[model samples]
Target: MPKKVVAETERRRRRPTRQGTVLSEKLIVQTALRMLREHGSAGLTARRLGAALGADPSTLYRYFAGLDGLTRAIGEELMGRALDSWTPTGTWRADLRSLGLAIHASYLAHPQAALLTASRVTGRPREIEVDETILGILRDAGFDDIDAVGTYHAFIDLALAFAALDAGALAINDDVREADEDMWTSTYAHLPPETHPHITATAHLLADRMNHSAYPAVLDTLLNSAEARLAGREG
Candidate 1:
């Protein structure tokens, strides 16, 4: 290629650089989300992000206070996006299930980001909406204010716990149920023939019970307990 052609190609490839003017806070946060999706949490840093954006590393300060601030922003962005896309039908169980699964699926969609963001409580506008909606559902289902909020708290806690646990399991490259099965097998597969009487004798059945999904039975049990508890209570 000629010198003129080479120069033009380089110019086209160059990044925008107006120092403080070119990099907006919104742009930084937005780019961070995209980076999180592509590179995972550990890959995101101010210096690396600046290079990707073609701005000076120090210029990022105009947008975010630092790395921690950027992480929180990304968390809030993800939650906001998830909740904005949600619309509640009138069915209480259906709505609750939708909310729990939506959040879990969205988080698991980006495993690294999920692990980082799952533990945080942003208390942002979207979070407030979620809380209010949950409490309202419980109240409409015959719970009083205290009971409603208590149920809402339990629901939120369970969703967060499940999401966090799922993320952690995936982070270690383990299938959630499979990991539990392995634990049961490694610990129980070789019980002693003499010393431990009760457990050693039951080893065969224990092996049979291991490696299965306990969610169905456990959830059924929980549902029964909830029904019994609610049955005797006044709304």
Candidate 2:
């Protein structure tokens, strides 16, 4: 089916459940996000979602085609939230940095949901808006068509890659995550400096930094490279 037709069908319904809970696309998407957070991805089944909304499982088809559609909706919601309070700052690098951080922060807020949807393209309204905004920033920053497209792809892919990696770490169960974290100190730190000279020497620094996200540093590097490319093209 065509995308507009699908969108129209999804939006054409808003009904009250037997228990009087009003059901709309926004409500369902928000509830689904909550479900993913509280119950994890595996727990967000049709039956559970229906029960949470006081509706029949089949009722969700009125708003979303299936689990995949709902997943995309949830992804769109994440994208929307990221851009909710953000506006372009006119400086391309600064604006891109802010937008990148916002998206990463939003995904990490719901790691389980992010695990399912962070890397997928929804092609929905907010997702399109984000892409357009990025392209606009690049074009306005004096990048020509080829450079703008290339840099836009790199910037978005880099941000999403780190978001997925960080969210995956956050999605691990608490006990296991703690044990994994402790390995930096308890395992690597204790390695003999003779056989494992480099790791042992930098073990303290590794442990201190391992717990933090590298998105910001990586983002700066990417922007710097893009800036250099722009300058080279001008020269």
Clashes of each: 0, 0
Q: Which digits, one per residue and each the tens of the lDDT, describe model 1 over residues 79-180?
A: 666677677898666676677666666666666777788788766566677777777876787767776676666666666666666666666534765767
Which candidate gets the maximum TM-score versus the true structure?
A: 2
Worst 10 residues of 1 by lDDT: 1-10
How does candidate 1 fare on TM-score? 0.66
- The per-model lDDT (C-alpha) reads 0.65, 0.88
The TM-score of predicted model 2 comes to 0.93
The sequence of per-residue lDDT tens digits that candidate 2 reaches over residues 63-106 is 77688889999999898999996887789989999999999998
Per-residue error for 9 in candidate 2, Å, reads: 9.5
Per-residue error for 152 in candidate 1, Å, reads 1.4
Per-candidate TM equals: 0.66, 0.93
Q: Report how far residue 178 has shifted in candidate 2, in Å.
A: 1.0
- Candidate 2 stretches with Cα past 4 Å from truth are 1-15
Residue pairs with colliding backbones in model 1 are none
